[model samples]
Target: MADEIKNTENQELDWDSPISKDAGEFEIPPIGEYTFTVANLEKTMSKSGNKMADLTISLDVNGQAYVRHDYLVLTSNMAWKLASFFECIGLKEKGQELTHMPWDKVPGARGRCKIIHEDYNGRPTVRIDRYLPLTGSAPAQATAATAPANDMPFEV
Candidate 1:
């Protein structure tokens, strides 16, 4: 099994990739060049054709699978959620003008941020300080800041 967030040691997760961003006080993760890869769409196979309970995805960076969750998403909803994030922040989509591309190995979200993962008191949080890219102008110099309304580190 892969190491959990709390158990993993901090290392040079993004050392080789060259990063680029505007030369102003841009937001933290909203700016910066990072390398990322999305997991290919997969079907949970079982002899019993019962509906799946959740979707499992393996998010990676240069073949390094950093995060994995079972049964959280598996249909168009998850794909749309991730795609909308890419569209919202003005990141490059895999297939331009082709609309509604499949969600396999697409250029997944990239940007290092002090991520706060939840809204309630029991929400999880994390800070990704790597080649995380930010959208918008350079004035958004990234730093420790509170998550915006209706989002707790949903910037992915």
Candidate 2:
């Protein structure tokens, strides 16, 4: 089922809300003017609920910020819409080497769209960081060589 999304990169959005108007034709941003991209999307549905997904989107655009953590968490369908938008922005799928981020999730009936805000400088900037993942290096190797294996009995 997910393959449908993983296949082709080109796709259209139903865009059922008014909020998308400002985003639809967003300029690609001048070469060095600014760099924006949806970084990661995460969704979790209550095991007992009627398929309601709680979502948190992280972004890595411009400097760094998360406009909204609870941006909108409704249903799987809506979640994909937000995910697709990010994909189109080149942030979700920039490349495999530099960074790897998850997808954002949204609810079915996300109310009228509006710009999410985050405190950046003295101004209220959008929280694009919500779509990004925390970046850090792997742990270092132990100072000693290969240590002795555990004696506990536990077959593979």
Give per-residue CA lDDT, model 2, range 22-135, as digits (tens). Answer: 422222211221223223334556565543433332322343432234333455556554454344333344233314233332221112122344445554444322232212
Residue 28 error for model 2, in Å? 23
Off by over 4 Å in 2: 1-40, 46-55, 59-62, 70-156
TM-score of 2: 0.24
Leading candidate by lDDT: 1
Over 1-156, each residue of candidate 1 has an lDDT whose tens digit, in order, gives 221221134455477866563543211222223333333334464345433322222333334444433332335555644444344334534354435443342324233222223223443322232223345532121234677587855555
How much lDDT does each candidate structure score?
0.35, 0.33
TM-score of each: 0.28, 0.24
How many backbone overlaps does candidate 1 show?
A: 22
Against the hidden true structure, what lDDT does model 2 obtain?
Answer: 0.33
